[model samples]
Target: MATEEVNKPPSLPPYPEMIFAAIAGLNESNGSNKSAISKYIESSYGDLPAGHATLLAHHLNKLKESGELVMVKNNYMRPNPNSPPRRGRGRPPKPKIPLPAGAVVSPARPRGRPPKPKDPATVAAAAEVGPVPPRPRGRPPKMARPAGAGPVKTGSGRPRGRPPKNKTPFAVVGFD
Candidate 1:
């Protein structure tokens, strides 16, 4: 069982480790430039799949944000030794700075379809930003009757029933 577990392949690639290794392996002077890191990864392992570059970039960017790596110009670099090491990940502390009187901090939007703003003040403020364009109403204005092509005879594909011949009106439920 132990050997089987060890032999089993990972369902997903270890992207974080790969990205970190690629960045760390860079020469101090190179500053872990993105292209260099990507090339290194390809050479060491295999080509990344289509649309994967963005995901890989996100990982690298997170490292830079967390102070695990430093960015200089277009390249990322090792953090300075003098600065204290970054803390472990968890909820970040809230801002302690106080807002001036009359400041309004908008609440965080919930995930998925956002609710419309109902507050009159918020509505007025939004209106000031730009003129609200009129919405399209009813059926869309169709193309000009195809330049004398004549109106399309509308109705189902069924043929019209034969007309009654007798002068006396027969019971009729429908019309063509």
Candidate 2:
């Protein structure tokens, strides 16, 4: 039994690898459709699991998502090495061009909207005497209250709670 097991062809590779092989074997320039890939797998690998179709579909989708395989018109093919990488959502970034020889590259500016440009004279003075300290982020701290200060009063002297409703009714004018 041990010898017979050893003689049996090496167990088939995992489903994904098997599927890739099937696609390669078909060698269709336009790429192989799911049905054709399934047929090739069935014929080339005789010991497929009972859920072979499901396994193939799942792995194909995964391969497509991971950029290993591309699906076009429901047919699967390996991605071309020379093809440009797929762009994500939103506008694609502009391509960077090579700088000419002996070009002087400016230092990269800091990321967010740049600070408003300072007057050149102020900038020159700043470079000689160290940079101005950055201002603190939020509203300036409230002016410190004097230790002896009392609650400030509003100009009108009326006390604060809601006033009671008036009990009187107004006379109504009727149509003649």
Candidate 3:
């Protein structure tokens, strides 16, 4: 009787699958050079949809942080094979703006001289005008009724004018 070989499904790696695949491919192809790994990753995955490169960079950084990968000079990174080394000095410190301790900053004062006084003619014209009277505060004064006119009677139980006529004619009477 022939023995049947059992095939097992591959297990997923704990890290990001794409990155793991990329690292494995790089190791197989280039024998584990960081530059080669970087080149392979760029060539294989860099042309993916726009945001994928950023995601790939983030995953690669996470792998490096977790001691699963190592970055070399010139932006090259590969699967870590040795003890994690301390990171090199990062970008130089930004130029410092040193403020003195307990410094009190006051509001900036106007820079130039006061504007020149109004022209002589304008000043004289302004001086001739008297102070304006204060306006009455509440609603405006009601309109005045016409002189010698009384209020006209309206509907409250008072008789209105003649009733309206209908289209039908009443009996016609001829009078000489």
Candidate 4:
């Protein structure tokens, strides 16, 4: 019975529970970083496996992803239940206001610019004066250039802004 007891392996707590214990026991106001947490665990548990470091990293990532742990500035700590959930990228949605019973909600206006209202007097005048012809939909056909006209002269095709500096010797003014 004594030999059997001597040969038995030591029991270890779950990685998550060990992590929580480390954070709590270390009592860091900001939080404990990965190195600190790992050190604490190693010192607390004497019989950790050879791959303990990799295992710890995997569990830490899992905890952070699942919201079990909050990481800030590379340090890890438990999330505060009292704190509001973290906001997403953009501005938060506005809270909806409840309408009272029997309240009438107006329908949304049509999207584009509203048609211009006709003047009441013009409308009545038009009715008595017979219908006017509707204007053509697109720009009127461009007037034909007179037979004598040709393309107007525009100074060489260069853009019509400030001229670029001239490199020619003629452009240089001599004070002498």
Task: Answer with 1 or 4, whichever has the higher lDDT.
Answer: 4
lDDT of 1 by residue, 131-154 (tens): 778888898886766578886786
For residues 21-109, could you state the per-residue lDDT of candidate 3 as single tens digits?
66677555333444454466557654444455566567767877876666555342454466556555788568888779998878898
lDDT of each: 0.78, 0.89, 0.62, 0.93
Per-residue error at 16 for model 2, in Å? Answer: 2.3
In model 3, what is the error at residue 8, expressed in angstroms? 28
Worst 10 residues of 4 by lDDT: 144-153
Ranking the candidates on TM-score from highest down gives 4, 2, 1, 3
TM-score of each predicted structure versus truth? 0.39, 0.47, 0.28, 0.48
Stretches of candidate 3 above 4 Å error? 1-15, 28-50, 75-176
Taking every candidate in turn, the Cα RMSD to the unseen true structure, in Å, is 22.3, 8.4, 18.8, 11.3
Off by over 4 Å in 2: 1-10, 92-176
Write down the lDDT that model 1 would get.
0.78
Q: What TM-score does candidate 2 reach? A: 0.47
TM-score of 3: 0.28
Q: Which stretches of candidate 4 lie above 4 Å from their native place?
A: 1-5, 87-176
Best by lDDT: 4
Instruction: Name the lDDT of candidate 2.
Output: 0.89
